[model samples]
Target: MSSVRLLIGTRKGAFILTSDGTRKHWDVSGPQFAGWELYHLKGSPADPNRLYASQTSSWFGQVIQRSDDGGKTWNPPGTKPEDLMGPDGMPKGESNMFLYDTSAETGKPLTTHQHYDGTQRPWEFKRVWHLEPSMTDPDTVYAGVEDAALFRSTDGGKTWRELAGLRSAKGHLWQPGAGGMCLHTVMLDPGNSQRIFVAISAAGVFRTDDGGRTWRPVNRGLKSQYELPDPDADVGHCVHRIAMHPSRPNVLFMQKHWDVMRSDDGGESWHEVSGNLPTDFGFPIAVHAHQPETVYVVPIKSDSEHFPPDGKLRVYRSKTGGHEWEALTKGLPQRDCYVNVLRDAMAVDSLDPCGLYFGTTGGQVYASADGGDSWAPIVRDLPAVLSVEVQTLP
Candidate 1:
């Protein structure tokens, strides 16, 4: 009787939302590519009908769709949008490849390093901010981009390859974090598939154990003082989200840009649990598929008022992992409600009384099949929620 396929990503399109495991009667179909910009959509815990999408656009760029019947129908794996026409055949639109690797092996040329005021900048091609499939290879996948790099595709979303050793290991001391150097968070260690973990928003968490070639800066004891002046530097520090609980894969959970961190050892080091959290200033940090110390966040109302604090809307639940917190607020929306929760939006679903999804920026998408105490709104208004994944069909 398994069912529940949420996979939403908005700002314009891509939704799926089904239900049957009684996720409370949902069945919404989608905005499906109806204007593009679906920052992420994932499925394929081995192959739940395989699905992947990153569609994007500035006017039309970065496609990467794919969906083998799970997401209804989608294409673009080996090209087919009129075959990317041209020569007057019409559609010669978005496919300029997405390059980066202007030398690597540290042989320079990512504009020769620099930056921090030294300036040098080059590698551009934005879009795709998180889409990781392959917890066992449904054609494998992983793509997190935007000035920050990391790409791979083992034949499921057409082709892509750029594990350029995480921009040649240092990528010249990464920067940009008002949300530009986006690698948006990617965690895969279902008990060690080579070990991987990423999150970069100013450049903070990074770890690779021989898989993505090599990567380091685990940002020890992360502290951002106001976005680093040396707030214990190891990497600039912005990290808006990171969560792990594949049966305790070294324990890690963060939602920085303010605080609410933990890292038993996998991330090397990190500490502020943001205890009693009311305003640890937030984004998204979740865990608790089966409660590996249970975790989740969504405090907001800081970093210049992103919303939710006295305007209500809470969802704090930390069952002894962090410094203690608990603010579920049954059915949510505590008051005027201002909305803002992004950092891959928020997700969790291993069913059987462990489901808790999230999405906002005022477009709503909350859910909680008995996890965060309570909540609903399987989809409300749509169009601003940027990412949220879930796939448990059968």
Candidate 2:
């Protein structure tokens, strides 16, 4: 059997964790792009050997890097398809920048418009919120940006085409909450390349079955915590992360802002699964690749404080369709724990029994070999992790 490799993206850099699929011992490498903010890291399904990382720097702006030799070395794409230019050598008018304002200051725009000037250096590129490789064609890729724009690439990362269908008709009506309405998650159905699912912050979820030709809101049965009166109102919910079952195409799960929901009919509707979960305030949700009935979530205190419940770190698992929950932290930190796992920081393996992986704001990576029954810290003392993914080598 091939060894399992874990790719971790953090605020400080990127890390790789490899194991022999037997012991507690793990080999860790880097802080790749050291001191840079690594937001998302993924391995291309089209080419498992190829790895992609989305990074941003206070001085360098946003960029995506690819590595062929695992995590040993990485190189930025020669030409970022998302950075398209017009005939006059100026970047496309759609090119824009987003500035996140998390301070108490009010009346300030959460993001501002930034235009591309010829005087700017070539290395400066647009931010990538989500990156997806076409399942039908390896040369094609898709990227979603913070401006809520969708971009498509036919020649890998060398060129791009903007898909204007995702922009809201009532532009600027959507406001950024705590995390903003960025398109952070894009789910592509493996069975049909034309069908796609995207998760947004304030706007909820969207579905495009005709390969982005047309889009519709799939936020039915979801809750919008920002709204008064009925917080569990459908169609306006704030969704953090979405996970689809690998074997069952019709089953999917979502980690919402105030509740955990599962849809058995491919996201057309949903039902609350938060009855057994500790709290609905968590960010990420991970479903087992082999077991469609099993799902995992890390719950934290949902209030403004946003800390681990009971000041303890735990991973909760539901084996019977969210009817009940069990704590999966055996060897993890027991006391005074305040680490919070974000929306994209948790993942599960493709192997049988399925290994589970999750990263935290405390800069630690936890792994479980026998499902979510037990856990251990594989890597520590790194930057705050934003996302984690696992791939089994052939």
Candidate 3:
């Protein structure tokens, strides 16, 4: 029988949950790097057993760990890659490296951010918000980081080098959102290896046509009153998350700071699909693995108050893409449930009668074995849940 593994990343550590196809009783194993923040954990699609995790800390900075036998064991890549740069352009002289092009087109070092005091601060590598493994190669993976840059690890997460073109494309226009300019969502087009989509909070959406070499802002129709002075500005919209079904790669769905949107023409343009959703101010948007038109979003009350509407935990599903929605609340709490779901907390597995999974800030991970008809908590009472990824094992 086939089985499933839920790779859960939390504020404190990482956990692994396993179950058979039934997905009823589960075996939970972890708190893996106890006391460290595991921002994201994802398995390579080409090799299910190979996994990568983004581990970070205030004192230790960032570390990338890999596991070959699922989550049973983990180790830093055997070779030590040099550090790219410190918080500033100065060298930290540490190992486990990140390499970004030092010299800019103008013969000056890259300037990534501006501080509150109006000082120009060089881009600092904070943490990896998302990790995307190549669909065809297990050893190739991509990392999206804070201070807004993209890095790739070709040796199975052992080493990384920034795709510096993304920083050069519109680096000056990119400003930090309240969340500090993190690239939280990375999507790969399975049909076109050259196409990639990424969402950065307070920076809108960007797409690369020729892989990661060059990128352009794709916020044509997005309107943000809170962050952008001009409603139709080139960039500077707070896009919470974006999702796409593998079968229909061009069609995209977005969960913005205040609205749910859809892009039909490969993100060259977009339109609001908020529909009848009570409040589209939520994080995390996902698509059913088998049903391309079916989508899911968890609607929170507002940006200031990151809780479900009316204290009701509901997973809104749209069977016709968007413009219409139905609430799924069979087993969820209806009152006093103020937990918020992070942008990377929701995921769907490619199983028959597809399974949906999401983690909450309240330290609970919920699962719906039969899509969103009904649901149950797989585990509860850990650190705040940051991300949830699922792998189907043959």
Candidate 4:
């Protein structure tokens, strides 16, 4: 029997939940590195024992911490891979410099931001959208930020470089949304490491077949926010999340602000899979590791209310590629439950029977071992959870 370890990243810190494969009993620990907004956590696919956490603070900005001896103790690197330039270092012809200056001049200090500090404030570090390990090389890693940029690290998390492809697109620099041009999700194809897929908020989806050397918007068949929209408009669509099936390379699913879409042709084209899904207005979508047609989603009321559906909590599962849906809430809460699950909160494991997990804004973590037929609360009474990940140890 294999034991499972769950890493829960929350608004205040992180919690490690260990359970027997049955998930019958759980041992939870932490508030690990308190005062930091833990956004993303993942264990190295090649080395299950090593862990990486993306943390942000109001005073310290953003930092990635690593733990080799499980979650026993964490070590923050002396210098972060990504660098934030001071106002004096702003280059000429940079339009964003003004916004950066205004933010620095008025909004406390840059170090108080998410990527800089581990503190939480109403307005700091918009979000750390995605953390990905390099499929081609385990030592390499990538992180996407709300500022609509990609940070790459070749030496695990020791050093970093910003990908110029996104920052300096041809003819025009990508404009920032309310949270700036945030790159929430970065999808890398394991088959072809050079081919990359990135989803940007308010910028639709982009694909680069030439290894980030170039990128093109692949938002065909996707809806736009504008009332009158171009059928082929590649920009202006807000994508909440994107998921790829590990077994099938071509099949992909996306949770959009307006619809759920499926692409059998590797994101070149898409069709609405939102048929049985609640309302086409939620963030985050998880796919089963072995079953490409099976996926999970937690729907909420739109951006305004953004609470559980009808103020009720439910997890919808679509087994036939979104052709139909089923709600799974066996052990979940009922009545006066208004917790909201974010774009990165829900996750699935690659176990044989498959493990389903999701974290809530109410500071709780739920796991279901037999798919979504039933569920159990593994960890409770923590900060607002931003993301959840599970890794099997040797």
RMSD (Å) per prediction: 16.9, 7.2, 3.7, 7.7
Compared with the true structure, model 4 gives a TM-score of 0.84
Query: How many pairs in model 2 have backbone atoms within 3 A of each other, for residues 3 or more apart or on separate chains, i.e. clashes?
Result: 1
Q: Give the local distance difference test score of model 3.
A: 0.87
Candidate 1 lDDT over 316-389, as tens digits, reads 99899999898999999889999898878888888879888998978889999999899989878988888898
Best by lDDT: 3
For residues 127-235, what per-residue lDDT tens digits would candidate 4 score against the true structure?
A: 4556787765666777777666566767666655555455333213234444455788888887887888888776678887887756777778887555215644656
Clashes of 4: 18
Which residue pairs in candidate 3 collide? none
Misplaced by over 4 Å in model 1 are 1-4, 8-18, 24-63, 66-70, 81-83, 87-96, 99-182, 185-229, 232-235, 238-254, 257-273, 276-323, 326-354, 357-368, 373-394
Predict model 2's lDDT versus the native. 0.72
- For model 2 the local lDDT of residue 214 reads 60
Task: For candidate 1, list the clashing residue pairs, or say none.
Answer: none
Each candidate: how many clashes? Answer: 0, 1, 0, 18
Model 4 stretches with alpha carbons more than 4 Å out: 78-127, 168-180, 225-232
Could you tell which candidate, 2 or 4, scores higher by TM-score?
Answer: 2
Q: Which scores higher on TM-score, 2 or 3?
A: 3
* TM-score of each candidate structure, all chains considered together: 0.36, 0.85, 0.94, 0.84
lDDT of 3 by residue, 1-394 (tens): 8899999999999999999999999999998999999999999999898899999998888888888898888877643335345568675433256655676652135566544444556877778889999999999999999978788878777667787777765666677777788989899999999999988877789999998887888999999876567888888788999999998899999999999999998899999999999998999999999999999999999988999988999999999999899999988888999999999999998889899999999999999999999999998787999999999999
Between candidates 2 and 4, the lDDT winner: 4
